[model samples]
Target: MAAEAVPAPRREAWERRTTVPLVVLGVVFIVAYTIYVLAPWIPRGPGSLLFFALLAAWVVFVVDVIVRISLTPRGGRWAFVRTHPIDVLSAIVPLFRAFRVLALLRNVPYLQRRSGAAVRANIIIYGSTYAIVFVYFIALATLQAERNAPGATITTFGDAIWWAIVTIATVGYGDMYPVTAEGRFYAVFLMVGGVAIVGTASATIISYIGEKVSEVHARHGNSGSAASDQEKGPIIEPPGRAIQDAIDEAGAVDDEHGG
Candidate 1:
């Protein structure tokens, strides 16, 4: 592989430096590709422009793979590609371009740090944002693929969004559906991502609840210890109290004897 010719250090440096720009490129590609898919009625010149944009994005994706392979510890390109099938498919299958959003995972921790949010709150916010974005993109893809297809029930963006929400929630209301295989694949992808998000959210909630319970238990334990100390009696201990009572009895007997 030509990429294998590149020095490992250089490849890693390039990846580190270009990671942000690559993410930006991926977003741009997604937008351009969406427009291309949805607006088939557009003129040839604009369509050509969108096509080139997609091609450029594909090139970047390919470069990323090669660089990753070059930097691989021992496995080389083929092994790396074999392990990450999604990466291989992302560019070759243009429909998988949306899969690039998985890159956002790298940024999630950074975002959480910048926002200074608790883990649970951050997870909820991130999950909600991700879910919304995912649903919207899936809807757009579905709309583009299914809109002009024969016997398609999803002609409008509204219908596409509704279908996406329903499908992702595992609620299969049969009012709308994709006619094309490409669109159906997107739906499957959406469902899988949705399930993953649900699972993550569940874990986050459980962890947060556990933390709260632990805090409460710890707090109660401290209070119980304090209560036990208080129960040991006043400033003077039990023996001191007994000695004071005996002194008072002796004084009372002396008074009676003096009377």
Candidate 2:
């Protein structure tokens, strides 16, 4: 008897849903974290909101990875695993400080294709995504380091958020510092990370400027072509007036010779 036919593998529905939620969660987390870090004067409830929002972000990230792996083309999984070994560990990574947040970086391509208002919207969305990830990681590191230190004022979530902002901005305001050894180590890491973030922002800005310049150049070129065509009118070359004049002169010469 013939073996039962194997059913074709189907793409996961969850994968399709992942993109929107990932983007939304990234934005929410970034905003919450930013407010938590930058505005310590704000009450504790907002910090709690930021914490829960980060948790939700991790859940979304996990779902997105599972969906992506499940929907990945057959035989593509091994290639993906080989190329992105981090994806395998994404499931088990700690929600608070996971680097999996970088996975949402895929939206850059989509951001590049948009135009006018759409492009502006994408820029806002992309910026928020990066900001959220950056702030969340900074807050997590700062909190872990600053907690339980002698005379450490950064014990509260708000203080931690403030430290994160200062750290990421590379302000290094000596007012709040990590006293514990672990906190100091984390601070070193944060400073390095801060430099990288700043560099990335600069690069992104340059790329956006280049894109705008190219667009302007294309528009100018098209308009110049259109204007030149309008000014020159239709391109009909009248029969050669110079050649006719030469022919008439030759005939007069011949008539004089005959006379």
Candidate 3:
């Protein structure tokens, strides 16, 4: 028989339980991948070990995706896949697994707090972090891909870094550019990521400015109301301000009539 889908609550609980561990693994994977990319002189034995470790980490991520997919309700499995493109992509594409390091942001204490401001804060934090990491990795990967190729403009690490920055900013200045197929492939991703980061930052700034303007207007409106109240002199609240005030006013009226 086919496995039954787990309830949403249980799935969420599983996610929460797995987040930190996966983040830790992601960090390890990044470090290992970085070493694997930048260091090509290691002894065969150690290199093999590192290779297995990286493979193991990838397997874990793939298994995590499978488990989550299985837990999702049958009706919503497609929705889950649609919403979690990164997770799905990371599991399927080894090159994208580097992006998994982003999960580390969720473990930050300040971002973990539950507050109205936390959402925007998370966006800013994630977007900035994502851009930096993306730029660095793309630089390294592009350098690896282009360095040995004939007529490669981005032959050195510095050239690769410059190229990555310009490409990610969508500013292809032409001083440095990728010449290899793999390098060009990474350039495409960098451009897309750049557009996304720029858009997010722009939206966030506009949102914050709009909020500030509204707050200033609200404060001005409140102060104007207070000033108007003061200009009218004492706020001689109508006598029936409360039940007791009404009762006292009625008693005074009776006294005035000697009733």
Candidate 4:
């Protein structure tokens, strides 16, 4: 039982140590990929450098996922996979290298230190970051896929980005659309991602607003109670004073009766 229990903690420790580093590497991957995609005419030397950088970051992500899975207890490996499908996909899927940045959601320093408002705020910020990163990469991928296809409407990077934005919002404006199979495939994922991002952002904002409103109400309630307490001051006399007054009245009644 002791040996069985050890792996879980070790795995948790490993994750905690690696989370920030992996997020940093994901940033490196995005930067390299962005340059590579946008500057197709760059000289071979710089291009190769970016390629290797992207590959290195991707290799690290793959290895991280493998290590995490190996550390998972045999009995719960399935659960780990089920719960961490995004991590698995980001590591395995070539295009999903961009999605590796989503790991930022796991252990952002600011988000980790607080709950409620702080967390909701971080979610909104990081969530927007993830969406922008996702759109950028998917746009590049779509551009590459559709660039050579006959009658492709998304030949340029700008058009690809526009299509991605509209598709993800489920607002296919009909002004830009994917023509090739690969582009359409990316489009499908982009659409789903858009819905998830928008939904999560909307929900987080609503929760933050609700929390603020509740806090306001709570402050008002406390102040109202304080005011009411002051207004209804001393509804009952102090026990000592009441006792003294009763004794004095009894003495007066006895004096009157005696007289």
Best by lDDT: 3
Predicted structure with the largest TM-score when compared to the true one: 3
Count the clashes in each prediction: 0, 2, 0, 0
Task: Give the Cα-based TM-score of candidate 2 against the true structure.
Answer: 0.48
Summarize candidate 2's per-residue lDDT along 89-146 as a digit string, tens digits: 5454442324444555554576557566466556566555656665666566567557
Off by over 4 Å in 1: 1-9, 44-47, 76-79, 82-86, 95-126, 228-259
What is the alpha-carbon lDDT of model 1 when measured against the actual structure?
0.76
Off by over 4 Å in 3: 1-10, 44-47, 107-116, 228-259
Which ranges of candidate 4 are over 4 A from the true structure? 1-7, 16-21, 43-47, 102-109, 228-259
- Pairing residues by index, what is the TM-score of model 3? 0.77
Q: TM-score of each candidate?
A: 0.70, 0.48, 0.77, 0.73
Tens-digit lDDT string for candidate 4 (1-259): 3334334776798988998788788778777767776777864363487767877887888898899989888876767777777688878765666666676565557777687767777877778877887788899988878887898888888898888888888788898788888888888888888889989978987897898999999998887777876685767989999999999999999999999
> So what's the TM-score on candidate 1?
0.70
Determine the C-alpha RMSD for candidate 2 after optimal superposition of all C-alphas.
11.4
When sorted by TM-score, best at the front, the candidate numbers are 3, 4, 1, 2
Better of 2 and 4 by TM-score: 4
Residue pairs in collision within model 3: none
- Per-residue lDDT over 82-191 for candidate 3, one digit per residue giving the tens place of the 0 to 100 score: 77888998897655677776776777888988764787899888888878878888888888888889998887778888888877777889988888888888888888
- Residue range with the least summed lDDT across 10 consecutive positions in model 2: 1-10
Candidate 2 residue-wise lDDT at 182: 69
